[model samples]
Target: MTQVVFYILPQSLDNEPEDVSAHFIQACAIAAFYYGQSNKVFIFTDNQQDAFSVDEYLWQFDGDSFVPHNLLGEGPRYGTPVEISWQPPTHPRQILINLSSNVPKFAINFQQIIDFVPASETLKIAARTRYSTYKKMGLTLSTHAVTNDNAVESTKKAED
Candidate 1:
């Protein structure tokens, strides 16, 4: 099994603590839906004192159709504490999706950081479209399509 892990970083114009949490949770839900469509098991890990709050919020979105395992830290120091100053709460939020032997077709296309942040309605739709595209390609939800050599060559030419 291969596990693809994505970490969500909060983006807020203001330093309001509440906004940070809200954005992080939204990103988590978006990521869960995308991964869930591939029939992958999704796990959420966070360091918030009220991780359950975020979990409950995500559970409210029914259309997502992804049941995620919530892993919360009791406090900043749970099992082992790392030394870092000014640790952003969002940095610790992560979504781990486990795939079978095959890699999903859309994995490479959607791996860009922008796909998982600020979860918006447009982004949700795009994610669904990508998921459906993979299904129609006769590829298993966990199967990744081999990259075309020509596409690689084109990219290399553009860089040069």
Candidate 2:
């Protein structure tokens, strides 16, 4: 049974297009922490651009640390803890973190799925739909509403 979790990011104050960069960095930090715990993570983006963005941010997310990761179609780099892609992982079965607008097709492949809903109403609605879909699928659902304070706490927990 796949366990699906949604980590809702703090709502943006302004009405600009949700800057996902900070969220991505936070996601990367969480993934890196899980990697430390010996879990492999596959991050699914909506498209190649998002994948590239994640790839770049992962490098600079932590100046002192590094997360072993590669973009999809780069050939499998054995020992990489993280894999970022626009498509589902070539080989399934890992902790999946989805940044896609819609629920990924391969959501069932992994034992666990982590997704986030930003401040945008459009995104919130989409996430709701995904949540319902997951519910209908009979998967376990867990949600964490991330505020700035808790976001910092999560980062600290990940670091520890």
Winning candidate number (lDDT): 2
- Model 1 C-alpha lDDT per residue in residues 92-120, reported as the tens digit of each score: 32222311112333333222221222234
Residue 39 deviation, candidate 2, in Å? 1.0
TM-score of each: 0.29, 0.85
Model 2, span 29-71: residue lDDT tens: 6788777767888998889999998988787666676888888
What lDDT score belongs to each candidate, Candidate 1 first? 0.33, 0.76
Which portions of model 1 miss their true places by more than 4 Å?
1-22, 41-50, 62-160
- Minimal lDDT window, size 10, model 1: 79-88
| Model 2: residues with Cα > 4 Å off, grouped in runs | 12-22, 75-79, 155-160
Candidate 2's TM-score: 0.85
The residue pairs that clash in candidate 1, if any, are: 102-142, 103-142, 103-143, 103-144
Candidate 1 CA-lDDT value: 0.33
